[model samples]
Target: MRNTAKITTAVLAAGALTLGLTACGSDNDNAGADAPLTVAATPTPQGEILTYVKDNLATKAGLELEVREFTDYVTPDTAVQQGEVDANYFQHQPYLDDFNKENGTDIVAVPDATVHLEPLGVYSHGVKKLTDLKKGATIALPNDTTNEARALKLLETNGVIKLKSGVGYEATPKDIASNPKNLQFKELEAAQLPRSLGDVDAAVINGNYALEADLSPAEDALVAESPKDNPYGNFLAVKKGDEDDPRVRKLAELLTSPEVKKFIQDKYDGAVVAAF
Candidate 1:
């Protein structure tokens, strides 16, 4: 009887050891590996911003910050949506709103500085100023809603176009109630606006694209959008569930810091205003 009791106790102990080993294996499977904080951004301004953080801030924050660069607008948001990236720094509120509506995405804005406001400036190849352009001068601008409205507003500001009464913010080309210049507007790609400068009498150019085309916003713009009122101000973009993430907060902190402010001033000059 004594031998049988001991045998039963040993079997029970062996069973407990097997259960414990299985639990440990399950935990190892769940916690597979540590991944670094991955941030994706466009190649122009936002890329520059993230590069600063990745080069400077990541070491102190105890993070391996990997920044991926995307060329066009569609893929960055798509990458974030598909969980290919942890975060992305790109696009303003209006652009984001349009993207979310069209794609059925729930990506959220993480707190970050408005890195740069790409001023929608109307520039002329032949004429020096707004008054110098002839009546019925052909004007070129981006066809997109955000940029088109911005161009129209600037035109209205310079007494070129009179929009509908009470159409303060939401004014569109269709809202143009009067065209005193009879300026024919040619809707082109934002990237193509700089090229259209020599073709048309004038064109409204985005800052980054203008830079790519070797046009200086500081020197060339006959009239540029104010950094204060410009709608194309960009921000840090993150996945829907990660707004409250610690890494995102840290990255945002680094972006809005005094160091970055100086970097913007030193590097971009007046072209990219630090919109913190």
Candidate 2:
């Protein structure tokens, strides 16, 4: 009886070890080179661009690509940090820095993977030009930290408003040094800025949201940020240790390839500019 009990215990222990090994093997398989690289992106240019690569470039490059689209800014980074997705391609460095700092996530950009720049633009339904806006006019701005500062800077550049001296990407309404037009500011989510145009005199919209609403940054904007010397070029990002994944490297290469650059110019017609 004693010998039988000891044998039973040993068998059970060995079986458990085998199951644990199998589980580890399964995890390794999922992280293997051939596994699909799932990416999260906003729908407009980022999703469209990734879809293009998946359909046209990925197979030829020996990569399996999957793109998931999210409308809001917060989900993609969270997804990447939680390992829900392999990577994301919807944000610039400043915004990623701020997100990581605030959320305690360790997301990092792939080196040299800056794909494109979507110039932030001010759009208005009733106003024909930035200077034409009436006094006490209410203008909508994105409520996010980095983008709000970018919007304020654009407004300053167009002589619509003024920011405090030496205020950089962290600037806010509180940082305004001058208000020549006495503009009333309305802060809303970036995704909601397009719909706010009718409610406000003008709106500073991120380029992706503007494109989703069929508004062209080049043609429709009262004032658009200049691409030259702009620091807000969106890039591919991954969790802290996944930068060396071969699939990520392949996608990064494909994103910066000449084909993508041509595609951006032709498809967007100057609305989206390739940074690579």
Candidate 3:
């Protein structure tokens, strides 16, 4: 009887060991597979869009989506370049090109990953229209090269300002050929433009920041970038050699999915537009 009891205990211990080993093997197999794909983005549309994906789509698709919000342009790209984050979704190609060139970072735009365009719009509190502004009325613009140029182009397109013939994406206030309103440009960081509206006659605010401040570009903008052939759509980006990372591919697919398209259309109300 004693021998039989000992034999039974030994068998039970062996079974437990086998079960534990199987469980550990399964966990090991899924360790990296289940790891989160962290992406950096700006708060309004980019962060909101990613949050939608994470809440509605990621679990069903088996994606562990994580989003980090950034207020400035420089950090997201640098984080990806340093492998601090898996991907980023805040910048257009032109801005990325300038960033890579200036910072000597190898971050690359995800292949075929045009996500959304946040049309740079001129917004104001003092005037209902761009034409209503008094001469020499101060207008604030983003100080960054890419957005400053874009803001100038928007002004030029609306006939508020004119550029030197053939002054392209790199245009600046110095490139303005005519300022019929004699509009004075106060150059501030993009994030600060919304707050500057009360102090300045008008401010050109990027779509994301504009949205964050509860200003709808579609309704509030005095003038906005025409979507046709606009090249400043924001996109997902990864480090150069990390392009083929499966997590990135999954996110890229999800970002351009029909569901995301509908979400953008419904949520932003034309303040944002689908680029893919």
TM-score for each predicted model, relative to the true structure:
0.80, 0.89, 0.87
Q: What is the C-alpha lDDT profile of model 3 across 1-276, one tens digit per residue?
A: 011111112333453224221211112123275677777788879988998998999889888787777788887776677654678899998899888888888888888788899989999889998889999999999988888899988888888988999987677899998888788889998888999988999999999999989988899999888889999999999878777777778888999999999999999989999998
Candidate 2 lDDT, 106-170, residue by residue in tens: 88999989999999999999978888899999999999999999999999998878899999878
**Which has the better TM-score: candidate 1, or candidate 2?**
2
Best model per lDDT? 2
> How much does candidate 3 score in TM-score?
0.87
- For residue 176, model 1's alpha carbon misses the true position, in angstroms, by 0.8
RMSD of each: 15.3, 11.2, 13.4
Distance (Å) between predicted and true CA of 29, model 1? 16
Q: Which candidate leads in TM-score? A: 2
User: On a 0 to 100 scale, what is the lDDT of residue 99 in model 1?
Assistant: 82
